[model samples]
Target: MSEQGSSDTYEENERVLVHHQGKIYEAKVLKVEHTDTNNKRKRNTLYLIHYQGWKDKYDEWIDSSKMLKLNEKNKELQRKPLSSLKKKPNNNINQQHQQQQQQQQQHHSEESDDGRPTPTPSPSTAGTSTTTTTSTTSTSSTKRKRVDASVQESQRLDLSLPETLRKTLIDDWVFITNDKSLVALPRNPTVSDILDTFQQQHQHLEHVKQFADGIESYFNKALGVMLLYKFERPQFGEMVKLHPNKPMSEIYGAEHLLRLFVKLPDLLTLTELEDKTSVVLSKATEELIKYVEKNASTFFLKEYAPVTTYYSRLAN
Candidate 1:
């Protein structure tokens, strides 16, 4: 369940040979768990566990502690006896070397073929009933590729909210989804690209001022007030960095912010008051604990961790 040797690659659903009870077994990963070491005095590492395996033509869950990962080359070598594939003397070493070089070039080219950036739908067409196209231009090619097919039929919603309000809402969401700790927008993401139309509705000046005012107004409230105040300075830093380029809401998706905020109360509900030490509050607060409980079961699904990491910035 742990990386034993020198390879840095481990992928879900890939076939792996592991040693269990002195027998070689084929297994696929069920999950990857990262052991937190920020607070501990030891080196931190991740665990790669394979709970299920194919045995006797039936699927079964087995204790993964007995398993040891085998290198791919070792596994392949094991599949064939050492005597069967004896190396022959190079009667045509020059020709063989050229052929080897050509094959190596082909492999290198194939790996570079994975350089395309994955395209996602524009935020504008989130929930509407229309279709549209959002083209993504690859650096390698001059022609723009249509990545978002839904754009052709998606119903466009009004994105006419006042800039101030939009910024506030987007700021909050960015805090929630990105963990309010991001100093700037990630490279390649423009303001418009991250903001969805649904969020634009809440990004007006009146809305943002109202939300800011509400934070002050509700400073005495039990649920949101304490949480908002704790994050106020960081949120300001976020806004400060976001100014002069695009409105806050445009840079930070508003819907994502709201989802992050709404989860606070539920998160608070789980922690014991006495256990609310500063260390826990800073790293895994009650809200974070709740958020993890709410989503932990799904974090192991192949795509979950990446999305969760994006949202963790907000949680932070």
Candidate 2:
């Protein structure tokens, strides 16, 4: 950003809207980092903001480009969701799956990247798992726009789930959809926490380092729209009420994240991404799944919160 623009706009305590991942949140500036006095003319302005109505932990420093001045026009922008293209997707999220049914026409899940550097991506599309309460790669200032799903024949993209996780998916499906249950909130080892744990222990893994943001972005994006089952929607609404501006990565656990993989191939195919890209994302996903399996007792919950009658009423 021009020093001129930085000088003219926003100051401490000023309220604004921030475009993060595929959504926008209302924020108030706590501090402004502009070192123009050191002759830094071309540096963009960074705002350390507290997302209004959210906890301080979610506060972050974002560059000017990601922010919008608070006004009626921008408020309208904040109210509507940005498409995958407008928000940007990480191809490192390149996990693939099958569109087994023609009726499974869910929009390909979009993802939220950390605020970081861009990894060179091969031409592909992927929906990766992301967690929020801990560490995900910082979103890069430079991002590749996601490929919009086109009007073409859909194809198959698959990931082989380990038998353990396969069973977990079945049980999860039964619990949430059939038994009227919900994964309790403020989930232990949230999606963000799980990813952080994966990064901490597996620093040696190349893909983990390369596509951290992509994995995070895709998971957050998918959870907001594509990942939740119908019965869980009210619980999701409850989460939104509690953490109004926070991402799902902060609220959900491995069980919900694992479900993304089972459906990612479908999310990926929705994009015009090549079949080859699926292989790359699928492999990276396998590694993450293995880690979760190793710590299943720790990362996943054996018991779920029963859906309350009031929450069920919201569904009717």
Candidate 3:
């Protein structure tokens, strides 16, 4: 379980689960809440999650204790063994071969029917016309083609954020002051809102605004959205302040751990996916993304794109 606060629940995009709706699912928590109604306050804490399928349509809520923290070890344990059912063998010969044999037999009968043939050397003919029977046996075995190497490698990967982000979100942060434990943040951060809070700390909203713009412009909208998800808006500045010299991938490694999908353009069945997907993407970077956008919430080892360590980290 993640080291979340007793009072604070975890979100969906940051957690992972399996056996959801009768299928194994690997997902991150998007939201977490407790359902408690007071006379004036209505608190329904439901954790919105982003899993393999459903993208963001379905969410599950339980008491804080029921929410399990997603980890690499847990993911490996969820894998089920593949069924060994084999396909029936097919040994039928081609129809063309049968037709050719019939044609040769007909030609031989016609040749034997020719009236000009009159060679009859009694006992010598019997010896020369001796029949010979020969038998030939042929064996052919079919082997299933192996899965692709790139696909196999991708399947082996655990698509989640880095350990540092995981520890920060679920564990107690190293506190320089008493009564200070940093909570794990949302996968996406609202940059403007975060910059607003930083305005007070920086003593100038414009300076912070400029900095926020830099972050926003650092990557395209898709990656920017990923950044928001990896870090809570409030926690963004802290990560940058702590690792100013690091790349954005390292700074946003936690969101990467969730293994978010990017739509690769002009790949797979594009029309079918576009018609079904709820999340929209731009014309650019369409080729750079992966997975066909669909509502189905299952992640088959064969379906996900090529997984690489470079894409796995936020620092790069």
Query: For candidate 2, what is the lDDT?
Result: 0.59
Q: Provide the lDDT at 137 for model 3.
A: 22
Best by lDDT: 2
Clashes of 2: 19
Predicted candidate 3: what Cα RMSD to the true structure?
A: 28.9
lDDT tens digits, residue span 1-316, model 3: 1222224346545755423321235556655544333222434444545544442223332233223345654343234221111121231221222233344345234322111111111121111212233212211111111334234323321222233322222221111011122223322333333333344454433344444344334432333343232213335555567766754443342222222221112112122333213122222112112211120122111111222444334312
* Residue-by-residue lDDT tens digits, candidate 2, 1-316: 2322123367899998654443456779998764232233444455667876654535555556455678875565444333332343343211110111111122112212111111222221222334563324433321323222223224435455676775576556545544567788888889888888887887776667554557678888877576776667677787889888898898898887787766665566666655666566666677887888898888878877776688888764
Q: lDDT of each model, Cα atoms only?
A: 0.32, 0.59, 0.31
Q: Write the number of the candidate with greater TM-score, choosing between 2 and 3.
A: 2
Evaluated at residue 34, the lDDT of candidate 2 is: 48
Against the correct fold, how does model 3 do in TM-score?
A: 0.21
Ranking by lDDT: 2, 1, 3
List model 1 lDDT by residue over 218-311, tens digit each.
2223222222323233554565575756444343322323333433333333433333232333332233223323433331111111223544
lDDT of 2 at 13: 98
RMSD of each: 23.9, 23.0, 28.9
Using TM-score, rank the candidates from best to worst.
2, 3, 1
